[model samples]
Target: MRFKDKVALVTGGKNGMGKAVAMRLLEEGAYVAVGDIDELNIERYLSDFASKKDRFIFVKLDVTNNDSIRKCVGNVIDSFGKIDILINCAGIMGPVKPTWEITENEWDQLMNIHLKGTFLCCKEVISYMIKQSYGKIVNVSSVSAKEGNPNFSAYSAAKAGIIAFTKSLAKEVATKNINVNCISPALIETRFLMEMSEEQKAVLLNKIPMGRVGKTEEVAALIAFLVSDEANFITAQCYDISGGRSVY
Candidate 1:
C-alpha cells in the first residue's frame, strides 16, 4: 500500500482518467474524495467502487466556480482530516474549429475550466498542505499544449497555461515538502475521444509512432508513481504519456 494513510482529492473523478486514478489510489489504500459536476454518473461511479465505499466519497464540484472549489476542499478536509494528494483532472475538450470561427464564450469557458480551475483548486488546498508540510499535486495537461493542435487553439493555450502554472507553483512550494507536476497525454481512450469526429480521431492517431492511443490505466499508473513517495524528489516536470507521439 504505497498510499496507505494518504488522503487524495481527484477532480473530474466521475469518469475517464480521473476515475481510473481514483480507483488506483483507493486500491493502494487512500481515503479518496472525488469531485465532479456530473451528478448523473455518481451512482455508476459508486457502483464501480462498491467494495471500497468506506474510503471513497463523491463531492459536487464545479471547477469553474471558486465557491464550489472552496467548499469541496473544505468537505474533503472535514471528512479525512487532511489531503495529501491532489489530482487536477477536470477538463473539457472545448471548441474544435478554426481560431477565428471560435466564439468568445467558447474560448473563455475552456480557459476557465482547464486553467482557472486548476488554480482555484490549488489555491484552496495549498494552505492545508503547507500546514502539514506534505503534499503532491498533479495537473492534467494535453499533448496539444506542447504541439499546438491544428483546430484546438483555445484548448492548446489553456493546457499550456496549466504546464506553466504547474512549474511556477512547484517552485513556490519547493521548500514546503510539496511536489507539483503535470502530465501531457495524447489522445487517451476516454469519452473525450468519442466526442471527436472520425477524421479528427484518425488525424491524431496517425501522429502516434506506437500506432495506438493511450489507455486510462496507463495514465493512472504514471500519476500513482508521481504522487507516491517514489517521486518525492521529482517536481515541476511535465511527463508526456503520448505513445511516442511526443518525444520532448
Candidate 2:
C-alpha cells in the first residue's frame, strides 16, 4: 500500500495506459478519481469496481477546455479532500501524414490534447500540491518525442513539449516536495496499436530491439514507482519504456 491514504487524479483513465495506471494506484490503496470523456468506459469502470465505489470516481472531463478541467479538479477535491498524485495520461495520435499534408485543425487539436492539456492540468493542480507541500506528477509522453517518428510531426512536437513541461514544473515545485516526471513509451499493445495497419505494425515492431511492443502493465509499474515515496529523490526525469527502441 505505497499510496495508502493518498488521493490520485488520473486523466484519460478510462482507457489504455491511463486506465492501467488508475487500476495500479487503486490497488495500492489510493482514493482515485478518473477524469475522462468516455462514458461507455466510465460505466464499465464503475461496474467493475462497484465494491470500491467509495474510493473511486469517474468525472466527465474534456482536457482541452479550461472550464472542464477546473470542474473535474474541483470534483476530485470535493470527493477526496485533496489531490496527492496526478497522472496526465490524456492524449491522442494525431494525423499520421507529412507536415505539409496535415490540416491546421489537426495540428491544433493534437497540440490541445497532448501539450496544452498537460499544461492546463498541471497549472490547476500544482497550487493544490504546493499548498500541501507534497505531490507527484507523471505526464505520459511518447518515444516519438525523443526520436521523432516519420509522418508524425504534430505528435512528435507535442510530446517533446510535454517532456520540457514536466522538467520545468518539476524545478518550479522542487522545494515544495513535489516530484514531477514523465515517461516515453514506444508502441504499446493497446487499442491505438490495434487501429494501425498490419504493415504499420510490422514496421514499428522492427524498431524495437526487444522484438515486442511494451505492455500497459509494465508502464503502470514504472509509473507506480515514480509516484510512490520510494522515488522521493527522483524528479524532472523522463523515463523511457520503449522495449529498447530508445537508448540514450
Candidate 3:
C-alpha cells in the first residue's frame, strides 16, 4: 500500500496505459479519480473493477478546456479532500504526416491537449499542493520527442514541450517539496500503436535495438515509483523507457 489514503487524478484513463496506471495506484492503496472525454470508457472502469469501486470515481473532462479542468479538479478535491498525485496522461497522437503536410489546426490541437492541458491541470492543482506543501506530478512524454520521427511533427513537438515543462516546473517547486518528472516511452503497444500504418510501424520497430515493443505495465511500474516517497529525491528528469532505442 504505497499510496495509502492518498488521492490521485489521471487524465485520459479510458484504456491503454492510463488504465493500467489507475489500477496500479488503486492496488497500492490510493483513491483514483479517472477523467476522460469518453464517458463510457471512464465508466467502464467502475463496473469492470466493481470490487475496487470505493477507490475510484469517474469525471467527464476535456483537458483543453480551462473551465472543464477547473471543475474536474474541484470535483476530485471535493471527493478526496486533496490531490496527492497528478498524472498528465490524456494526449493524442497528432496526424501522421510530415511537418509541412500537417495542418495548422492539427498542430494547434496537439499543443492544446498535451502542452496546454498539462498547464491547466497543474495550475489548478498547484494551489492545493502548495497549501499542503507536498505533491507529485508525472507527465507522459514520448521518445519521438527526443528523436524526431518522419510523420509525427506535431505530436513530437508537444511531447518534447512536456519534458521541458516538467523540468522547469520541478525546479520552481523543489523548495516546496513538490516533484515533477516525465517518462518518455518509445512504443508501448497501446491502441495508438495499432492505429499506425504498416510502414510507420516498421520504421518505429527498426529504431528499437531491443527488437520488441514495451508493455504498459512497465510504464505503470515506473510511474508508481516516481510518485512514491522513494522518488522524493528525484525531480525534473525525463526518464527514457524506450527499450534501449534512445541511446544517445
Candidate 4:
C-alpha cells in the first residue's frame, strides 16, 4: 500500500483517465474523493469502488466553479482529515475548427475548465498540504502543448499554460515539501479519443509515431509512482508520457 491512509482528490473522476487514476489510487490504499460533472456516471464509478467502502467516495463537482471546488474539497478534508495528492484531470476538446474559426467564447470556455479549474482546485488544496508539509499534484497536460494542433488552439494553449504554471508554482512551494508536476500524454485510450470522428481521429493518429494510442492505465501507473513515496525528489517538471510522439 504505497498510499496507505493518504487522501487523493481526482477531478473528472467519473470517466476516462481521471476515473482510471482514481481507481488506481483506491487499489493502492488511498482514500479517494472522486469528482466530476457527469452525475449519471457518478453512481456507476462509485459502485466499482464500493468494496473499498472505507477508502472511496464520490462528489458531484463542476471544476470550473470555484465554490464547487471549495465545498467538494472541504468535504474531502472533513472526511479524510488531509489531502496528499490532487490530479487535475478534467478537460475537454473544442471543435476541430481552424484558429480563425475559433470564437472568443470557445477560448474562454476552454480556459475556464482546463486552466482556470486547475488553478482554483490547487489553490484550495495547497494550503492543507503546506500544513501537513507534504503533497503531490499532477495536472493532466497533453502532447498538443508540445506541438500546436491545427484545430486545437484553445485546448493546446490552456494545456501549455498548465505546464508553465506547474513549474513556477512547484518551485514556489517546493520548500514546503509540496511537489507539483504535470503529465503530458500523447494519445491515450480515453473517451475523448474513443468517440472522435474518422477525419478528426485520423489526423491526430497520423501524427503519433507509435502507430497506436496509449492506455489510461499506463498513465495511471506513472501517476501511481509520482504520488508514492518514491517521487519525493521529483517536482517542478512536466513528465511526458507520449509514445515517442514528440521527438524534439
Winning model by lDDT: 1
| Alpha carbon deviation, residue 65, candidate 1 (Å) | 0.9
The number of the candidate with the highest TM-score is 1
Model 1 lDDT per residue over 74-101, tens place: 8998998999999999999989999999
Q: What is the C-alpha lDDT of each candidate?
A: 0.96, 0.93, 0.91, 0.88
Error of 4 at 172 (Å): 0.1
lDDT of 2 by residue, 108-150 (tens): 9999999999999999999999999999999999999999888
Using all chains and alpha carbons, the TM-scores for the candidates as numbered come to: 0.99, 0.98, 0.97, 0.97
Q: Write the per-residue lDDT of candidate 3 for residues 73-124, one digit (tens) a residue.
A: 9999998899999998999987997788888899999999999999898888
Quote the lDDT for 14 in model 2: 85
Clashing residue pairs found in predicted model 1: none
Model 2 spans > 4 angstroms off: none
What is the C-alpha RMSD, rounded to one decimal, of candidate 3?
1.1
Across 145-223, the per-residue lDDT of candidate 4 in tens digits comes to 8898878888899999999988988999989988899899988888888557888878888877788888999999988
Q: How do the candidates rank by lDDT, highest first?
A: 1, 2, 3, 4
Lowest lDDT 10-residue stretch of candidate 1:
40-49
Error of 1 at 40 (Å): 0.9
